[model samples]
Target: MNMVEHPGFVLWFTGLSGAGKTTIAVALEAQLRERGMRLERLDGDTVRQGLTRDLGFSKEDRDKNIERVTFVAKLLSRNNVAVLASFISPYIAHRDGVRAETTHFIEVFVDAPLEICAQRDVKGMYKKAFAGEIKNFTGVSDPYEPPINPEIHIHTDQETVDESVQRIVTWLEERQYIPAKVTA
Candidate 1:
């Protein structure tokens, strides 16, 4: 019997809120689907509401949250399912821990200026954070340790969503994460 190769992996996106992480992740997933790849997405907000419902926003809680997500991502990857995760993931140690779990891990940093992220805050999170209604908020009350050597960096403030998606797709193609296509 021919054994199927492990097809699952993770494209881990780290960024401050309102940095367009979710937007770009959804777009990337759609692009991958167009190429017939099976995938699943794990957004920070959605996971917090469910799997991480008991967790708080303290630094320790944030670390635990990422730990849980990393474990789940690894499990999914082992099953041959592509996993896309978008989270603030403020600490470099947390991200490094996640990276140690799988060879297919790709860290994509969605880099956007704090002002741009504040302006794009459709959820009013930045406003609340600035007003002190929220505390320990990343890029506001808390620090976000930017990735020093991300596999891909999307400067969302300077690029269109489609352009960002294309950049990620190009990287995946170049790295053989996804199969190369043929053209007549």
Candidate 2:
């Protein structure tokens, strides 16, 4: 079967912690890779360990983090690589900056209520934040500005991971960013 070649795009996932951004990105990445798409995943946790290791969670640091990631995403997406970035990215200005810098940018708001996110926190981050152990936590001490008009929005508390992935894939296909899957 012949494969469809498409231009590069950035699928940016943004939400508060434990809101299922990474989960959906991981599933969507698997699907895209299976379809033979060249892909890169720039996750917040992994990026912080390396690219933004020196940065704290201050507003300035958050901006710098997204700025660096945006630079990388811009280069890769323009070169026809699918860039999947999952970040808290709590500010609208930073996200808008990335959209302006990248090619075919698609913002995905993975939304879940603070209570739901806290319940889903396997890393105990929410617990610590509630206990005053963690400062500058989004949805807690820090502000997380929800996307005013994202390309896609998924409510993790309501939708299953598969449902969320399918929604994104369908959107991409509809927009011709990715061709519809061929079934045997």
Candidate 3:
């Protein structure tokens, strides 16, 4: 599987915290890797620990965060590396900026009700946000502007992870972004 034969693209997964953005991205990454694609997964939490460690959660800081990630994704995707990015990128403008900067950018909206996301919060961040302990939290103190038209929309509350991944993979194949899976 020569990666150069496959064009690079960026799969940007955006949703509320605890909405399974990272979970689905991880599953999709593994499936793509099994196909022998050159890939990289840029996660919000992980990137925050390194690349954007100096940034905070404010809107200005958040914009800066996405801008930095967009730069990295642009470089990787242009070089034939599949980029899987999962983030709680709440602003439409910021996401649009990424789409403009990256190559073959696909916006994947991981949709789930706020209540459902709150229930899935094992880290208690949502609880704190709801209680006013955590300030500037998207969907609580801050606003999360959902995508007007995402390339892929996954309902995390209704769909299983496998189902979501299959849907995404099928889309990529249909669009000729990725080759169809070869089964034995």
Candidate 4:
């Protein structure tokens, strides 16, 4: 198949807030860009300010947020643009719904224990959630539904960003969604 002539796949990275979902996605995006592939990223924090500003952190709001992002990803992927999404979409139903919405979807579970995520929280989300200052926070007050049999699973706490990105890249290459690495 001519990957360049066909629509690209949707890559969904899901995990806790500090589980390095965005970090790995950003690194993967950089790697994809370096290889001359056209891709777009839709991050939770970045989209919340625009696409989902009216939504809150409630369960319904979270589902709606995922729906919106999935809608956008569907459009882009249909047009041959690789849509990379980094979200703490803590619901399995919604994630599955997103998978159904795209032509090709890869669910990447960025895994890290809650303790490690808490330690990596630079925004103090974990601290605030632990202190009762934040409600409905995944891995704290709220719940996180880990991906069941995800396409790729990366333990961010156990791997560096580059390693995580390489894992994702390898998956894409194996499926021919992106070109394989060329040797010098």
lDDT of each: 0.88, 0.93, 0.93, 0.88
User: Model 2, residue 155: what's the lDDT?
Assistant: 95
Q: What lDDT does model 3 reach? A: 0.93
Task: Report the Cα lDDT for residue 23, model 1.
Answer: 96
Which structure is stronger by TM-score: 1 or 4?
4
Please identify model 4 stretches exceeding 4 Å from their true place.
1-6, 182-184
Q: Kindly report which residue stretches of model 3 are placed more than 4 angstroms away from their true locations once superposed.
A: 1-4
Clashing pairs in 3: none
- What is the Cα root-mean-square deviation between model 2 and the actual structure? 1.4
TM-score of each: 0.93, 0.96, 0.96, 0.94
lDDT at residue 43 of model 3 (Cα atoms): 100
Candidate 1 per-residue lDDT, tens place, 1-184, comes to 2222336779999999999889999998877776667688999999999999999999899989999998899888887888999998989999999999864889999999999999988699999999999989999999999999999999998999999998998888786777554332
lDDT of 3 by residue, 1-184 (tens): 6453578899999999999999999999989987878899999999999999999999899988999999999999999888999999999999999999989999999999999999988689999998999989999999999999999999998999999999999999898888666674
Residue 135 error for model 4, in Å?
0.8
